[model samples]
Target: MDPEGSRIQDDPYIQVMMAGSTLRKVKSRSWKKNRYFRLLEDGLTIWYKSRWAGRGHSTFSVTDLEAVREGHQSEVLLSIAEEFPAELCFTLVFHGRQGNLDLVAESPDEAQAWIQGVRKLIHKTQTMDEKERLDQWVLDWFHKADKNKDGKMNFKEVKKLLKMMNVEMNEDHALHLFTMADKSESGSLEIEQFVFFYKMLTQRDEVWKVFQDYSEDGEKLMLEELESFLSVEQHEGEQSTQHAQELIECYEPSETAKKQGAMSLDGFQMYLCSQEGSIFKPEHQDLYQDMSQPLSHYFISSSHNTYLLEDQLRGQSSLEAYIQALKRGCRCVEVDCWDGYDEDPVVYHGHTLTSKILFKDVISTLKEYAFRASEFPVILSIENHCSVEQQKVMAQYLRQILGDMLQTTLLDGQVPQQLPSPQELKGKILLKAKKIGGLEEYLDETCTDEVSDEEEMANCDAEMASTEDSPEKKSKAKSKMSRELSDLVVYCKSVHFGGFEHARSHAKCYEISSFSESKAKKLAKEAGTDFVQYNTRQLSRTYPSGLRTDSSNYNPQDMWSMGCQIVALNFQTAGLEMDLNDGLFRQNGCCGYVIKPDFMRDGNTQFSPDKPEEREGYKPLRLSIQVISGQQLPKVNQKEGSIVDPLVRVEIHGVPQDQAKDETSHINNNGFNPVWNETLDFTIHTPELALVRFVVEDYDKASRNDFIGQYTLPFTCIQPGYRHIHLLSKDGTAIPPSSLFVNISISELT
Candidate 1:
């Protein structure tokens, strides 16, 4: 995993004996010799004068390497080349960013081997990420622990291995593994055997029992037994059988690579850890949960300060922000409206130097793209700071641009007992600005979401003090809003939570409130049950506080675990937190809404986020996926404008943090149907909690690989088939039809 380390293990093709430092050289200009040379997957190292100490040494990463080949005339290799023999002379030149090193082998074949080997190492070394490092790290551990050098670890080694991995196990269980992993009864466990032991060592006994119960003969389950277990006992669909067959055949190795369907206990263990079957039953997704639960009962994908694309201080605000957010299945979009020239309102960060976009343009863009990506209702969380004239113009723009799609009245006007569902509000946009009722005259677009009394004044002071404004600008800051704009506030009336007891005051369908993450987490801790009960019927939002001004996100699952819907994130940012957000909503058809778990639903039966593992009916999964090949991969953004040395990375993310696994394919020189034919296997104990993402990147030798495209799907939504994964941008937003075609097999292990 070290980018500059020389002693690496994975590639055994180019063998190197421990030679003295007298054979190595660094940056050969005229001549620099008397050094030891060691080459790893990552780089080549030159140590001065036959020593492992750092007194005089230089490491060159593969990314820093320019080339490695036979010596050229007039090069410093002429001097060092004489040390070995005529055939052993090979020179390595470094890129502008790194130092150079030269190596001498014993024979011509060894020299060619080092040349080709170092080039291959560059690709593998530069492409390595945490997952790849883990893979290598495990291999490295296996090698180090094989003290007897029989390619297997003994019973004594097992205890040592467990300690090294930081595992805690009882004596009886350790003995059980000693026998089970010793499959051949050969008195020792090889790499695969140890891997099975590793998987078993980390898994839950209850989960293993569940998986074993699916075995018809109680000894082992092959493809037929698994299909029978799923389709008959589990009542899975007919395709489940196909998935089982495909997975078992893919996982069970055959001499001809055909369908053998032979599965040992270890094979079965790996299957349960994959995505073929979900740990949670389909019920967790509530696919059939009636949309009648009211909009507030579901989790809505929301955005915070949607106008700013970058940082809050100096970013440019554009209408594309709304389009991008909406296209990525964001249900709620925020807009900060300020008075612009000529009776128009503009959207921008209020207290920052961000550029502005016209409010009318944002409205029109929303009207066009609102329901294109997701059919669920769009909640416009407007932080209004416009004049009465501009507020009137804003209202006119909403009505004119949105037409009938804008919701301006209660559903049926009947004072219903429950709020309307997302289904009921389909094709409609709801205004979620503050609704100050009982006012003689409606204020202009000047009410905020929930910046607080003191915070609101501070934001205004910062906004105004940042720049000089005319008298009209000051007047507009305190202008009265038109009543027409206020009328648009139907279901999503942004209110502030007073207390856990008073949060119920907004229990009515239209009086929606919001809480920052700190406030919401506090409420959840102090009144866990009350927090749960409050969200049953009322609509509320939880947003990241201003402290997250850099646009990073808090783990939304923590908020989601408490059943708070409308968890707003800074949609423009990308990372694991965002990946989880995309994963959670990636279910239920990416419709911007997901039915709450029954425990979070009104009149809960028995569901608690803290005890997710104990949640009944949840099952483990075995997923076998073949990353076949990519078709027409878009070139990674580069000035080179080349076809691309493409590679595929398949990742599994979710709960059971340690169970997350990711693998990458070898670099394919072809973009058109580049046949990787690599199988990625995983056993997921928490399928409902896991997400699978495929990232295709263009490989580079001298720098980080440029991202080609990615596509993420909730493990539950993935169906077994020869499917085409239409890729998305790095941000999880849909791109063009450029895709990777792959075969998928999914089976429910328990």
Candidate 2:
């Protein structure tokens, strides 16, 4: 549907909620002000009442906006006859540069319906690419350029349109564009031709620079040059030349059929952005990073409550959450199973309003999507809350669904002093849950001796209460488990981490344990060296605390610093912490595992999170970064004309002992070609622990700044030399070549 023509009444979802009324427009809160909003097919239309509010009206995409229920003062009826809950409003949260908008429904029923309607829209929008979004933006602004309604735009109007897209064209270029777009020599551009011309012109501008960079005498590349470039640089495997030949044929078939051996600018553009030659360079950057390492010697990408999409309470849980996490390269997924309505077990937040999905469905989902995105072994972190019968069903379902993909034996029947590498367990699923009767055999089995039996029982009661205090918990807490489920626990054993001393005790097999952030931090601070030594042999997972009700994530670096193998995060949320997680795990073919630092892997080495690891690579390093041009910088939605004065801020986030902070410079209004021509330098003491994030923001004189896009990566994974940094959206979706072109180098200063 055309965005301009979309109305709320056209949507059946909206019609059911609003009852076919002409009440498409309503009052919503935006940026602390009341704004009139219209529900469009693609997004909500927002406009302020004040005429000079800079941004009079704009559309925020449903893909970037999520409707979440709010519990603050949501009074549907002021003076109610029947008593009701105080809060019933929903906040339209956006996962974009735009701030959140608030909407209140007349009743709780209406609020839920509206939430469902908007959520459906949000899901629909995720499929849309920024390219299509840009097209819509152009169409929205083009009518202004096509004045007098003759369905054509003259050269002057075309020039104005270019400026809106952050393209500055002089008279010579303007006339050339007019001539090219007006293929019939009509002296003006028709709408369809205008769109085609915009796409081609933008593509040309982006690809032309690279063409000039690689071309000699400022022209196209010969077939031999193209083949050499591909074979030597871009292609990963042994068939670079063959792939190059195929690429040339696909893009420059005309020249090839004529027996010419050249690739023009158009051909170059097609080749550069094609799947065969993606600028993001999907190939693994480091050969060593991709090599398999012991599961205990690497940090695994993991998610907490892999079922929940929103908050812990009342959030919708689905198999899609597991799919999303796995798709983003999460290898460890949490599935909290409880007794269901029948023979099948269910997965959800134990005692919350969150919806539940069948345990069989979740296991089947894990089996289907486990290695599809990441080839490494997957660990199903099971939080068991089922009765003996239900637990039997859970085990049965796992065996039935996952089949032989589940790992049932220790590698070679003997637990290695160190855990098996991910390579040894490829395509295997490891169940991580506590075994009921295995502790007596493995006497030194991860039992914490610090607490007495009475204290342990009391603690278990408290834990049960904390998990869920309902009558369901009472029945499930004392349930017996089948020997079959116990047999499935081969590698990932759920054990309580005692003191550091017991962790390094004898006869300890490939047992794994978990700690909340608080407990992990306390243990690390209290026994830093022992923590490091223990991790060398056993794997430890650090999860976010129960206090994170919003599903927000905590920084995994502190846990990583302590050599915790699996620093699990809420993969459903996108923030600085998740950005760091994504960046750290981005290497190694994004197989969801990264080899730990050498010091952390050394069994006898003593290290502390409080200090830099005393290793061979320690040095005072100087990093110099040149802020160069950006490609297709998004327009500022809050501005009058979707314009922006762009700026780049380079931030170094690491330990306090490390070097400088955020350094920024503004290149007023030239978002398309922002150049500081100046290099920002930082001296870091702990180079390995540092994270460098590049944030692009729009400058506002009288108001707070607006975000444009950002790219964050660990210091170790950063590639030097002139390169294009593909940006990600606030929700971590690939924004493609909407990127920064910059030169980076790291030098040892001391």
Output the number of the lDDT-best candidate.
Answer: 2
lDDT of 2 by residue, 1-750 (tens): 355326534666655543421111222222223334445322433223333356566555454564443533211222221333334455565543233444544466666666676676665555544334555555655665675668788887777776766655566976776788788787788877787677666654534665676677566677666666654444234675666567667766355432566777666655554433432334454435634567888888988888987888788787768877887789999998887895778899977899888898788778878998777799998888776677778888888888889987666765466577888888999998756434334434454423343433332322233332456654544455555576677777666555677656643556677777888888877888788888888888888877788988888877887888788888777787888787777776778888877877888886665666365466768888876567777676734345667888887776545635564677666555565656788887776667787788888888988788888777876655455677787767656447776666677785
The C-alpha local distance difference test score for the whole of candidate 1 amounts to: 0.64
Off by over 4 Å in 1: 1-290, 387-393, 400-403, 438-484, 504-506, 521-532, 548-550, 574-590, 614-689, 694-709, 720-750
TM agreement with the true structure for every prediction: 0.51, 0.69
lDDT at 536, model 2: 80
Q: Output the lDDT of residue 723, model 1.
A: 55
* lDDT (Cα, tens digit) per residue for candidate 1, span 1-750: 343233344445335422322354535455544555555322333223446556756543444455565653213454454555657677665532122355666567666666666676666655664334334545666765676777888888776655443333456878798889888998888888886776565443433454577776665676777777566644566787687766666554343323446465545544443334333334434344466668767888888888766877787685556666786789999888888988778888776789888888788788888999777799988777776577778889998999899987666756567778877888889887654451212233465423343433322321222123334434433445456676677666555455656545534556666676787777766776666677777777877766676878887766776777888888778765676787777666677888875657764434444444565666667888877666546555433324567788877765433145555554644453455778888887656545677788877888998787877666766756445677766555444325665667778775
Q: Name the runs in model 2 displaced over 4 angstroms.
A: 1-152, 156-160, 163-187, 190-292, 437-482, 636-640, 654-656, 701-704
Poorest stretch of ten by lDDT in candidate 1: 458-467
